[model samples]
Target: MSWRTARRICRPTARRRRKAQWRKAVDAVAGGIERASAC
Candidate 1:
């Protein structure tokens, strides 16, 4: 397969994985802040 075609196929899932990772990181930080405030 050509390089451009392979990249196009892989791009969407990679983007989605990065987005999910970012969301998880944000949630963890928010949870940590809430716990700190509660203590």
Candidate 2:
């Protein structure tokens, strides 16, 4: 595949992975806060 085609495919996958990682981080923080508040 051409460089342009490769970039187009890889860019979205990278973005999706980054988004998933961010969501996981947010969820972990939220969980921690909830646990702390419950105490």
Candidate 3:
């Protein structure tokens, strides 16, 4: 595949992985808050 084609495929996948990681972090923080409030 050409360089352009490789970049197009890889860029979105990287972005998606980054977004998933961010969401996971946010969820963890929210869970922590909930637990703290419950105690």
Q: Model 1, 1-39: lDDT tens per residue? A: 699999999999999999999999999999999999999
TM-score of 3: 0.75
Better of 1 and 2 by TM-score: 1
Indicate the residue-level lDDT of 8 in model 1: 100
What would the TM-scores of all predictions be? 0.87, 0.78, 0.75
Best by TM-score: 1
Candidate 2 lDDT tens digits, 1-39: 599999998999899999999999999999999999999
Off by over 4 Å in 2: 1-5
Question: Which has the higher TM-score value, candidate number 1 or candidate number 3?
Answer: 1
- Cα-lDDT of candidate 1: 0.99
* lDDT for each residue of candidate 3 in 1-39, tens digit (9 for 90 to 100): 699999998999999999999999999999999999999
Model 3 CA deviation exceeding 4 Å by range: 1-5
Task: Rank all candidate structures by their lDDT, best first, as comma-separated numbers.
Answer: 1, 3, 2
Residue pairs with backbone atoms closer than 3 Å in model 3 (clashes): none
The worst-scoring run of ten residues by lDDT in candidate 3 lies at: 1-10
Clash counts for all predictions? 0, 0, 0
